[model samples]
Target: MAKALIKYALTALLLCTGLAGAQAQESGSSAARKAVPKIQDGWLDVRAGEGQGRLPIHVSRDWSQAQPAVRRALIVVHGITRDDLLAGERAAAKVPSAADDAIIITPQFLIAEDVAAHQLPELTLRWGVDDWKAGFKAQAPAPLSAYAVMDAIFARLLDRQLFPNLQSIVLAGHSAGGQYLQRYALFGQGSALVDQAGVRLRYVVANPSSYAYANDLRPLAAGGFAAADASQCERVDRWPYSLSANLPAYARKPLDPAALMRRYLAHDVIYLLGEEDKDPHHPQLDKSCAGEAQGDSRLQRGRYYFAYAAQFPRDAAFKQRLFIVPGVAHNSTRMFGSSCGLAALFDEGRCTTEVAAP
Candidate 1:
């Protein structure tokens, strides 16, 4: 009988140990949700995904307290520089008067070396090359795509507990950041998740180098749009340009021109262009054959794209506008902070096509 008791005691102890370890792992996973530095004014505690996880989005110090008072979530994405923390800070400071209780978030997509160089905390996700820009899988140890990061963020924000009363979610980006949103708006699989969240969603694309066209039609140099000379540039309708073929992995499915067009038109989108950003041969300007197929200059392309979408007959409910911010060049700071920027964001600032050039 003593021998039997000893064996039973040993078995109980092993079971307890196993349970304790499982509980600890569960706690650790929960604790790993976010890591916030001691600093203020940026970097929130909203985190998702796994393995070398991405940075927690930046936010105002009072974000928690402000959640209850918030009505809008202004998600400002960074450009090719991947300096979203800084971008978020600057963009948040430019809030329109109408967005009295809006919350601003900036998702920081980093490079592997950037963390070590800047001494950032460990487990900070970083993409190799420009993979993140295309919503490609993140660097090894974490297979999360850039688009998935945004998806997780939207889900978290829509949580009844985190933000109980959000009325609008604005996904806005400039330059490379603009390119990300433009594609995500068309191909992000999370659109259904966002749509069901019962909040109004907005997409503001500011001064992107190019756009994803629904058809193979390319804008002409002399006048209207037309099909590209297939023999000359057969790859004209490729990914990131015209949804022709070879879509990136993050592209949820094959680009269905008609479906994409309907989805894009149904969403609330605004193309905010910088009027003075008209340098046809600007060094940073996309000189790629695809870009040239759009227009000669950023200003021209924005105007042309807007016209194209406006003329699309499939979706009669297409309600998109292209607003040119006066006197602003290729600067997001001035572009977003201008009175015109305020209007695009909060629906209450002065913006008109007719303005004296700055």
Candidate 2:
């Protein structure tokens, strides 16, 4: 009887051990599934700046383990309401695996509320919005200065050693995000990543509502009311008039229209506009700054801006790459997918001869 009891006890112990091992294996698999996908080939989260905001940095390759033959990085900036992860995911989905050789970095900025709650007052005062002081006080602070946030992200990228073969850094932005990049590329000056890495930076302005131009508002040769010259007038002011007229005086403070034009002309910037986006009847068409300038229409102001830039000799080379994708609107996903063909242009290749008319 004693021998039989000992034998049963040993059998129960063996069963318990097997169950425990199975449970452990299941737990391990679950943990692996929960992990965030890496940025390039690996995604990890890092504090982008001093704020509570955490940016998900995705890497296509492990730069530490092995150096990639093509050392290129693309910095994608999200629009006003979106985050970096979504932007990166969208870009990754559209780009082919062959292009995966490049490292992609998507840095998220603090939300509007965070920014308004903490920094709005200071920004308002700095911009001399004393008249709107009471209104500003009621508003929240901004997350970070557009420039400061970008600088922090760039610093983090340099520290990561993720892109050992990093040669060129393409700054791509859409809509309001494009507006942010527009200002940053022009005024942010140079950073350590740019200087130390010998990074050649280029701007990809995709369907921005408005851009900071170095040119003044010039009236068409014929009055804006004439039918024969309607096309030229149509090109003159693509945004809604009300919003354009109501622009905060501070927004126009710099007043270097010609200089802004010259700067754009000299830069290697590409403007990607959607062809079907010329909807004057859209709900938001007449609202806000861009819409208000367009006589409340959703006409293609970005295209006009590209054409205007081409009129100048400095922008001749850039004018060749201006493109309008069919069957797309103010949608970033569609625009990115349509413009994927231009990926080669982003490489160390020469510009194509075909030019879209201004």
Error of 2 at 310 (Å): 1.8
Model 2 clash tally, residue pairs: 38
lDDT of 2 by residue, 1-358 (tens): 5455443333322332323222321112332222222222232322313232333234444544544554556677655443324554455555565265566666544333333444322332111111121011112132323355456556644553444566676777765556556555544534435756666666777665554433233212221211111122232222112112223222334434455445545556666666676764443222332222322222255654555556655634553356566677877666665544245224432324224755
Stretches > 4 Å off in candidate 1: 1-52, 61-66, 84-100, 119-122, 354-358
- How accurate locally, in lDDT, is each candidate? 0.66, 0.44
The sequence of per-residue lDDT tens digits that candidate 1 reaches over residues 3-42 is 4544333332232232322222111222222332222224
TM-score of each: 0.79, 0.57
